[model samples]
Target: MNETLAHEDLPDGLGLRLKVDVTRPLTDLTAAVNALCDQVAERRATTVVVLELAATPVDFREWPGDVGIQAVNRWERAIRRLEKQAAVTVAVARGTCGGPALDLLLAADFRIGAPGLQLILPVNDGHFWPGMTLYRLVQHLGVARARRIVLWGADLTLDKAAELGLVDQVSEDLEEALHTAAVLTGRISDRETAVRRQLLLEAVSSEYEDALGVHLAACDRELRRLRRTRDASPQNLVGQAAS
Candidate 1:
């Protein structure tokens, strides 16, 4: 299994289209992650469309010595960076998504799964691999369902995943999903989007009082920008002339 990652600009500069083939070893996956990070850091796209292809299962146990652990760490960091840095990240799951592929889906802002798509966890010797993937599942699905997935070895079907908020959309057509993602990313500045995403991420761990100041600041910034736009409009100019 040779995992690969590539990206190209969407038509009319709408965003970037990223294709990820997950059937590869950790070394290749790490390289792919690095490439993705560089692409996002360039800030050439406002939204990222992640096409997750079928993934070949990865066994962490097979990674020899410290090399395996280091690769895993780097891979996780790269995925986190993509989620935080990209203005809007949307993932489309086709066929089976497991291991590293599932990790990327969990990090995405929006997830769309194709019909018959299955989400799998890594199991070795009849036991689930205890890793950060567990944290992701728990964060998205809460404890009970995450437990079912991690401990009971349950696979998430497309409909069930959508019902549980794991997948935002279930579409048979990949193009439709991409269109939906592009539409959803419309009319927002990348910087503002990043701020809003940060707020949401922090809200999960912070109390209302702790988050109030940041939220208020964001509101102030938005209001000022709106006022500036209103003042610059043709309608405002006409009203001033009449006065």
Candidate 2:
């Protein structure tokens, strides 16, 4: 995974650029994802992962469920870490998405879907493949809210995805949507983006009383950081003695 990424560099400040094509083997896709995480951490910037899903059924080189559990676990963990990394993650979904594709989209900080985007969790042997994708759906839209999607699997049209808040933007011009997402990512500290993302993820299940202390601590940390920034300013430190 440490090998140099074959995609675009950090020249324009949009961190690593990577592609997720389900037609490829799971190993290849997972390796690419892990590499993206590493590069984003090093650059401390935003990353946009473009998902390439076939509009029709894919004859997967390697079925996601056919892979060993360890591999699946590793990929899922990478996505989880990616979600909490200091770098912002933006996902672009163009066609129908499901399985690993849907998992990646859910993990992203910002998701952009094409106007005709549809989401599904592929069924194998008459049962929906049980993966962390289901867990993520539950996390995003609690168990009750995600009943149909979890119980069996439901196709989510672009409009439905937007209504469910799964996608941040839908556009005919995916490139422009990505540009808009990149601009939005710049409005916040890369580190703070991860912090706030973690807070939001936890906010879903955490009770107010239990979450209060954690929220207060985050506020205090921010205040302390602000003070440190102020004290380190050139104007404020002009007369300070070298210690």
Candidate 3:
């Protein structure tokens, strides 16, 4: 909420990485979701949108039970958008994560956890909330593994989450970890990044037989792209002259 400390809507340069500081919503993020969309829609400049989660899982039990179904649906859609956003979405969790925080983290392309980080099931009156996060947990860990966390409310320590590949990196120094993440991703353009993400998602969700066609199409496109590059290269021109 500190405007002075937060980066502006857009990144200043190619070297800068923008962190999308999550506002711990009391009921929903419907109002702020547009900001998330805008961050990803930036076509001119490559950006890395980092969502920081520290005061998360702040007693979801205390949340009012009056959230409407429509609001929840909108929230779910927004989270999906975040997952497929062009900007490389990064989640940095410190302390406990559950509810919306957990949802965002799971949707991120990269996840980093600071020391003392933990994950908890978002339960309401003894049952887990049937949000996109639940579906994502199943997608990430599969049915057998997510069952324990959802049905039994099992909490995961940072080390356990990292072992499961839920948390990509664990660091005592979060800033350095963030910088490392930026380097690792190499900030591809937004549309291309989203296309790649969609391909990966389909690889997981699609049936084995159905996956082949999709992969073949991608392969064809890649081949064409490579051919274009090769034909335009200086070596190819020299070889053509020699021939």
Candidate 4:
């Protein structure tokens, strides 16, 4: 049976939590990822939380056959599925992070890192390993910067990563960051938020003219609703105040 450490090790109130300690055996890592993905899919949680590299980095070379491939596939599928559902994922990082840690970060919508956070893009003896990491890096950073990171295996400090827009924030405190994220997401209605998110996604690969009409109509609808709600306020109080 696959055993997971108790959740008490991390801070509380995360909808669904996934913690990966690379110091654990490869078997345990794969089990944790699979279990986490299943829980996320089942709950359809609005947020997916990750605690990354809390221990020594596990050497991918030590993983047995099929474990590495399955682990990567599980994470890839979970991230894409969650993205389509208007769910946001956050990666909280500390210490030396590369390989699978970097890959998971790319899969997240937001990344929070500590002072020592360093990013290592995948490369084997000067040859870049072309995988989902490369694909996502290119999508976010464009071809030139992506190539530089991958080919040369550049290490990015937390401040440097923030400058490059790789991470949302770099702070010593993880609890505060989590609370901020919760507050930001809590104010918005889920359905409306999902609609807006889908529209933005469509706009990315869509032509301006084609998206303009739909975008305008959605905005106008919301505006009209707000105006009506505002105007429908009680007039008796206003008149009493005037008298």
TM-score of each: 0.85, 0.84, 0.85, 0.69
| Cα TM-score of candidate 2 | 0.84
Decoy 3 TM-score against native: 0.85
| Pairwise TM-score winner, candidates 3 and 4 | 3
To one decimal, what is the Cα RMSD in angstroms of model 3 from the true structure? Answer: 3.1
Candidate 2: list runs displaced more than 4 Å. 1-5, 44-63, 231-243
Report the C-alpha lDDT of model 3 over 1-243, residue by residue, as the tens digit.
444224444233433333433343533354455555764575456677777776533575422245777777777777887777677877888887776677778998899998788887677776677777778888788888888777877888998899888999989998778777765564564566787788877776799889888778777877998999999899999999999
**Model 1 C-alpha lDDT per residue in residues 144-198, reported as the tens digit of each score:** 8888777778878888889889899888787877776777674453777888988
| Predicted structure with the largest lDDT when compared to the true one | 1
Estimate, for each residue in 1-243, the C-alpha lDDT of model 4 and write its tens digit: 234422222234445556666555445554565555565555543544454555355543322224467665765665455455444566788876666667667766678888888776665545566667777777778788877876766778888888888888888887688667654653452445656766855754679999999889889988997888776667855765778
Error of 1 at 205 (Å): 2.0
Q: Report the error of model 1 at residue 145, Å.
A: 2.9
RMSD of 1: 3.2
Scored against the true structure, residue 51 in model 2 reaches a CA lDDT of 38
- The residue ranges of model 4 lying beyond 4 angstroms of the native Cα positions read 5-14, 23-34, 41-55, 60-75, 124-126, 188-206, 209-243
In candidate 3, which residue ranges exceed 4 Å CA deviation? 1-28, 62-65, 187-190, 237-243
The C-alpha RMSD in Å for every predicted model, in order, reads 3.2, 3.7, 3.1, 5.1
Better of 1 and 4 by TM-score: 1
| Of candidates 3 and 1, the better by lDDT | 1
Error in Å for residue 164 of model 2:
0.6
